[model samples]
Structure formats: structure tokens, C-alpha cells
Target chain A: MKANYGYMDGSGEYYITIDTDKCMECSEHFCVKACPAGLFRIIEDDYEDMVAEIIPNKRQAIKYDCAPCKPLEDRPELPCMAACTPQAIEHSW
Target chain B: MVTIGIDVGAKNAKILILKDGEILISKYRESGFDQAGVTTALLDETLAELKLTRDDITSICSTGAGRKAVTFANEVVTEVSATSRATFEMYPEVRTVIDVGAEEGRAIRCGERGKVEDFAINEKCAAGSGAFTEAMARALELTVEELGKISLDSSASVPMNAQCAVFAESEVISLLHANTAKQDIAKAIHDAIASRIVSMTRRVGLNKPIALVGGMARNVGFVHSLNAAIEDEVLIPDSPEMTAAYGAALIAAERAA
Candidate 1:
């Protein structure tokens, strides 16, 4: 759970967010690989076709509604930060 | 040559002592909380029970989430490699391996020699992992062990869409309120997870003669759903739970030779 570096938000708080456009463009699903909680998956149709959509499958709707970075303990470790090849994920306050 | 494989899993630690192709001894114990401490204790106790010492083990390997933390291991191997090796050893015809443990689910393709060709793992969310099922079991006031047996008897089937474990629990509650049979609900949970896992397995290309390993592999109901989803008979070893440890042992033996 412990790692180096962090992100900052405009409010002077450190945070990380996923840019959907970058995520869609990225070919490698590194986020899926880096995640410890098994929260992200590439959607597939009934015909068993791998789709390009990437979704965060959280425990509850309310949990998803909360800001992307609620709390370290409340959310799965952000694999997107490590997965982003283009550095599309920004950890800022 | 004597070899040993230790699987320091999140919930349990297991040791397998082997000589050539024969299993000398195997032991599994609940890993209360500490990974390193519990693994050390388990290894010590198991070695003592077998009247063997650390030096008696020519090579040592570790597998599972806490593999890296096992200081006793000479080499740390990925679960994908270990699972495929173990599955291939158990069923030489097995070309695919599906592992569902407490925290992750993985599907691996093996080469003719049992080397990992390609693999996919679900380590990000609980929806497709055993933790989701455990959570659902807790909410239903049933032990996780009861779910598989109970689910096997259900005639009716329900559909659950929530891919998130927490959301899935809520869905199960709603279904229970509607007088849904527990078996039906359990079956739905297995089905939902199977669909997700099958999708990943298909992504990696599911060949025939698949082997299911890991703790969740013990769930007969889930195995049925997995088989049905993939449209193939999922091969499960008699000691499905020990596959990972066995795989580690296999690796240790090879290293020693």
C-alpha cells in the first residue's frame, strides 16, 4: 500500500485522477495489472468480444459517486498512476 | 533430491516437501495476520513434523501474494508460472489454468512444456475475486464454505449485474427480500463472477483441458459456473487448494536438479 510520490489538487490537497481520454487511447491495461484490489476490467460483450471501455467496478454506487480519490484506505491503490504510459494521470491538489 | 515449496497466501500458509516426484509431506495452516511470522512458524512446524531440517531441503521456492515476503525462499516465482507448472503436472493435457483465490483471479495459457505462454489476472477489484464471495457470504450470515454446497442444489437462477462486490452484496440483499432462494442467489453470484473471469480467459484465448486451482477452486458450484461459461470441462486436481504450493515445490525440485 505504501509507495513513493503523490499528486496535488488545485485546492492544495494531494490527489490523483484518471483522464478517460488518455485511458481510452492507451493500449496496455497497466492499471489492471498494477491494481491490488482487482477493481478495473475491460468490458466484453455477450459474444465474448473485448471492448475498449475501462470502468472502475467499486463496491457501491455511492462509493463511486464520491470523488475519485476519496481516501487511501477507502479506495483501491491507484494503479492508473503506475499504468499511465503517457502520464495521463495527474496527482495534484 | 529434496525440494520444498511454500505458499504464503493472504489467509493461509502451506508447505509441500517433495523428493523427486513423490510428495513427502504437505501441511496447511491459517495465517492469522502476519505474513512473515506466520509463514516462518508454519514452515518450522511442518519441517519439525516431518523430522526434517532447513538444510534437508535442497531448494526452496515461494508463491502467492506474500511470496516476496518469505525470506526463506531462494527464488520467488510468479503465481502464473507456479500455477501453470502445477496444473500441467497434475493433468498433462491441461492447456489452460484458472486460479481464483481470496484476492485475485487469473487465467493462464501453458505451452507444451507447461511454461506460461500468456496470462490475464484480475487484481484491481473484488467483483471477480474470492473476496467478493466471502463478503457476500458474510452479509448472508453463511460461511464461505457453505455457499458452494448450498448453491449446487438450487434449481432457480437469478441474474446479478453489479460487478462491484459491495454493490453485489446489496443486490443479494434485495433478492433475499424478494424471497429468492439462497441457492439461486449463490448461483447468481458464481455466474456473475464466472462471466467476468470467462471474459478474461477468452481474451487470453481459452484452449481445451482447463485446470482450476486456488482456494476458490474448492467451490464446486463456482467450478460448474466456470465450466458452463467457458463451455469446457474445467479440470480440477484432487488437492486443488495445494496447487500453488505444489507448483512452488515443482519449481524447487527443478532448481535443485
Candidate 2:
């Protein structure tokens, strides 16, 4: 199960993709701690399974909130992605 | 030379006209659905009041959330840059700026020259912004001003549990039904916002001589909450809402020169 968060705007497209299938296998939720903006959280879904989710309010303005970490030249590794031991998190810029 | 700075804020559009480093006039109007239209009308009205025309202005700069909507601006600056610039110009000793607007909150760490070294923003959520207090005030059947004033009289501290505005509204109503003092609820609301803002400020590293800008600065209760949370005296300009516009004007002056 792939969960997508964020939206595209006049500035650019930003998405934080989470592979829930891979996420469920992992016990440590590092993405929640790695996000500086506190935009990530773990929530129990309809299936009563714990999954990582993006805070609903941050979905629209992810571009601005993540702007500081975005680099102009080379793509830098994101802390949230790096922290995910299962490599379940991905960011599309 | 005359320069005009326009801040297309979420709730209002503020315009500041500067003539040779001195403020000539400042005006603010509610920003309706059409930000560009409101800004243009504001500029026209200000220019008319000062007996000046657009051509007479050496430069025009725009800042705030809808800054890009102002098509006539010579340049567009971010709210962080503009607010820090204005705050630093007024109080050179200010090293940190906490701006809580209607829809957003920002904490900026600046150097001695007012250049932003680091910053954090809470734009997506309304819980920590002025809108939270406004919503809570509506729930309490009190005006925003009255809410702030009444909060000062609160003797007991109440804690707000909700982190979202929607949830907080219900919490406020429940408190009201439970016969919780309105003053205590108001204080709780301010304290909640203050704690969120203080945590955001800590992200960029809090420095001394902090300045609080934006419309929230006008709320004495919120200011007191921030002061208590940060455990430091926070400086506020005469017109807290106009800081971004003033900074934009300063940038326009510099660019025109």
C-alpha cells in the first residue's frame, strides 16, 4: 500500500510517499522524529493498523515547510528518508 | 525619493509609503478574495492622499503570502526577510523575530545586521496562529479584543488539550458548558499558541532581544503568554502589523538607490 502526501502548486510539486507495506514491517518510527517541522505522525488507520502519516494540515504547504532542506544543485538526502530503516519513505520534489 | 511597500497579508493588505527614509503614510485594508485588487486600491488611495502618483514612487516592493499576486511590484520578498528587516531597522539589538499572523506563524533567527540566519514557519496549521484565538473567541461569544482583555484577568491557568483548531473549538465549547471561566479558557488559548510558537522559535535557536511582530503582537494577553513562555522580554514595534510592509519599503528604497 502506497500512501502519498502533499500537493503541487505554482511553485512546484512536492510529495512524501510512504510504502505502507514496507512500513508495517518496521517497528521503529524514525520518520516522526526526523522531520524537523513535526509534519509526520503515526496514526491507527481504519484497519486498526499503525501506520506513518503526514499531518493533514501540512499536506498543502509541504513545499514551503521543506524549503530549507531543499538544495539548489545536487539532491541532498532527506533525514526522514534516511531514518526509515526499511527504506519505506520517499520524497518527490 | 519615495518608495512604496505593500504587504498582502492573509487578512489585510498593508501599505507603507516612505519619502527619503521617513514614513510618509501607512494604510491597511481588509484583503478580500482579490488580493491584487485590494492592494492596487490601497496603493491608489494612499497615493491620492499624499498627492502622489505611481510614477512618483521610485520603487515598489511587495511582501507576505500574497506578495506574488501583486503584479506591479518591482520585487517580491519573503515575509521572513521583510519582517526581520523591519524589526531590525527599528530595534537593531533584536536577534530573533516571532511573527504570528492570522494564518501562519514564523520564528526567525537573525544576526547583528538583521540578515536571517535561520527560520521556522508553521503555515499549514491554524492551531498556533491568530485564527485559533479568533475561533476560540467566536465560540466564547466574545469579540477577539474582548477575549484578549479578559484573559488578563485570569487567576488560574487552564490547559488546552487540542492541537488543531477544529478540535480546540469543541474543547472551548465543552469548557464553557462545564462552567469554566472564560478568562481561564482565554488564557489557556493564548498559552497554547505561545507554547507552540516558543517551540518553533527553539527550532531556529532562540536568541536574546527577541521581537514579536504581526497582528498577534497587538494582543496583550498573547504577548504576556509569550513573555512568560520564553522567560524574556519581547520587543514590539508601534505598529506590529506594519513591520513587513515597512521592511518591504526599506528594501525598495535600497534597490532604488
The top-ranked prediction according to TM-score is 2
Residue range A11-88, candidate 1, lDDT tens digits: 123333445544555677676666444445655434454422334334222122222333322344455565667555
Model 2 chain A: weakest 10-residue lDDT segment is: A67-76
What would the TM-scores of all predictions be? 0.74, 0.76
Candidate 1: tens digits of C-alpha lDDT, residues B1-257: 88888888767888888888899888888876788888898888988988988888789899888898799799789878888898888889888788988888888888886898887776757766889889989878888878877888889878786766777789889998999999989888888778777766764567787788888988877888888887878888878878989998998888778
Tens digits of per-residue lDDT for model 2, A1-93: 899998654334579999888888888999899988888899887777788999997785565567545533244688888889999988896
List CA RMSD, all candidates. Answer: 10.9, 5.9
Can you tell me the DockQ of model 2? 0.08
